[model samples]
Target: MPTLSDHEILTELDDRMQMFIRRQEMMFVATGEPHDGHDCTFVTGGPGFVRILGVNRLAWPEFDDVSLSDAIADIRRDPRISLLFVDFARGAIGLHVDGKAKVLDDDAMRRAYRALNLDPSLDLVADRRPMRWITVYVEEAFLSAAGELV
Candidate 1:
């Protein structure tokens, strides 16, 4: 296993992030918890946007304050996170991202969100609330394909 660098993150996300976000059809997000100290993982894709930056950070556009707060609070306690992309039609890929996560509510990020077409949508067309983005700070990342060691 090798540590993921900032430059490599930029390249990988720029090239392959979209495929995971789009082609995979679904993804699982795992977050850290301060209570039980166990990771909380959930499947999220429908009615949500996955935005990747570099290798470590990920953001979701158009999330409400309630959901955003929950995600941010967990990140504050545990920065480690992992995202899994499963391609039922083909092979599978698991992307492990070990870093910090932050919920950002900034105008610049909002603009970028719009530019990237990662805006919040209620029905994939209607503009939604908050328009926040979850920024993941990457410490390490590993990619494993099917039948390979993860």
Candidate 2:
């Protein structure tokens, strides 16, 4: 097998990858702080609940009554985070995003929500606007192929 350098392992998201992300309704987020262990949780929403803010940034709403404090606290102390989105039905196709994350306050959340311009009538964003948002600044993106980790 040929050796792969970091440059070869990491890549920017292309149009096809972005489309895959848009179709995902669930994602797994993993966060960790030095010497504090790591926490991973599954976040779910309707399709398109997670928005790509730019080529290198994405944001997802944080709903109330969820047990995400450990993950959020870890992010505050150490911004490093990893997100995984997979197509279970199809299998073997997924995307891994490694990045830094921050919890946005209400004002920033509102601005991000507005930027999405989703239909106000959509149940996911209508009366249930999230007060908190987690924004990730992507450092690298990788494609998971046939059970291999990139």
Task: Give the per-residue lDDT digits (tens) of candidate 2, residues 1-150.
Answer: 222443234545666667778878999999998999999999888888778877788887776636688999999999999999988876758788989999997577666567565443443656765667899988888777644332
lDDT of 1: 0.54
Residues forming the 10-long window of minimal summed lDDT in candidate 1: 6-15
Write down the lDDT of every candidate, Cα atoms only: 0.54, 0.77
lDDT (Cα) of model 2: 0.77
Positional deviation of residue 142's Cα in model 2 after best superposition, in angstroms: 1.0
Error of 1 at 62 (Å): 5.3
- Clash pairs detected, candidate 2: none
